[model samples]
Target: MRLKSVLAILLISISATSCSLYNKLVYRIDVPQGNYLQAEQVAQLQNGMTPEQVQYLLGTPMLTDPYSSYTWYYVYLQQKGYEDPEQYTLTVNFNQKGTVSDFNLDRPLPQQQDADIKPLELENNKSWWQSMKDFFSFS
Candidate 1:
């Protein structure tokens, strides 16, 4: 019995130190939060879209102004144990009549680096198919 107890103590001490087996035993997961808007979904957004329509298309905004109902915010965050964190923000403003006035899809947080931000837009307010054609067409 004493020999068994000593062996147990030795095994516990071995696992307490950093080792490949220890690392595998401890699992870390990638975390993704908030509205995960795809590029295709964002391109579908347009002026005069109703709140309900917007919500249906893009799921839901992460934040909204309490003082004013005209603005909505969609924020995305991704954290990975082995890589750098990523964040995205989209701000949508509506008219008093509750129609989408305009939106910014590439707006970055103040602290985030500006290297990867790109504006998401459609030429002439065209749909996805039309935009794809426009991209392929030289003239």
Candidate 2:
């Protein structure tokens, strides 16, 4: 009976100490301001507007499609707690003449494979066998 009482007292003290330590270590959640380009402003873009004018209005595009420089894309992504993260996408397709041909808000893009180069792993390590293999394997 005495052992049970001591164990309960120890557990209560440990739990209280843990709670205090947790309160000190954990940080409060931060709320992000989920505001970006206004739809009304983007809707104002017209077919004849030049790149400079479009930039002036929308600040800057997030990316220019490598396949077509004429196409400009803008994207913003923000994630916070229980609220579903907000993502905005805008794409402006231009004619060959460098004028806006059409534009859309929140258009889906096809997934593309990344072609970025991987860092060199065996940059300096060249064992004699590796060197010999590299020299003779070319043929």
Candidate 3:
């Protein structure tokens, strides 16, 4: 019957559309692979701090110049599927005495107003089922 054929076609169309919709709505876990540093921690750095102190406050440097022991680099990168990757770099130069002589941070230090700001949402932390539910939620 034509009605049966039409119903079959409609069902097929609905299934196809639903499959595409689900694919689009499905959340892919963000891949984060690198050192991550907080603005507050970077701001705590001060001139004349010893290398040991710097290492204590902030973790080990990501990269150090092979030829020069005076320069140290702290690099951070975060990759998220839905958002732009976040990156930061800090460079520290030590004096002959092995104390920090100067340093530079790629991003500006957080101000008082920024202290209350929250970090970006980490989608990888959410379960796939939760993400699916959130994807379909009205709010």
Q: Which candidate number has the best TM-score?
A: 3
Query: Candidate 1 regions off by >4 Å?
Result: 1-27, 107-139
lDDT tens digits by residue: candidate 3, 1-139 = 9999999999999999999888768787777554567777887899999999999988889998899999999887766666777777889999999999999988863344766888867497997779889999997
Scored against the true structure, residue 114 in model 1 reaches a CA lDDT of 57
Per-residue accuracy of model 2 over 37-136 as CA lDDT, tens digit each: 6656776889888899898898778789998799888776655444566677888888888888888877443333456766556646887679778979
Q: What's the TM-score of every candidate structure?
A: 0.57, 0.51, 0.59
> Model 1, 54-90: lDDT tens per residue?
9999888899989998999998888876567788888
Cα lDDT listed for each candidate: 0.84, 0.75, 0.83
What root-mean-square deviation over C-alphas does model 3 reach?
13.9
Model 1 reaches what TM-score against the true structure?
0.57
Score candidate 1 by lDDT.
Answer: 0.84
**Better model by lDDT: candidate 2 vs candidate 3:** 3
Pairs clashing in candidate 1? none
| Cα RMSD, each candidate | 12.8, 13.4, 13.9
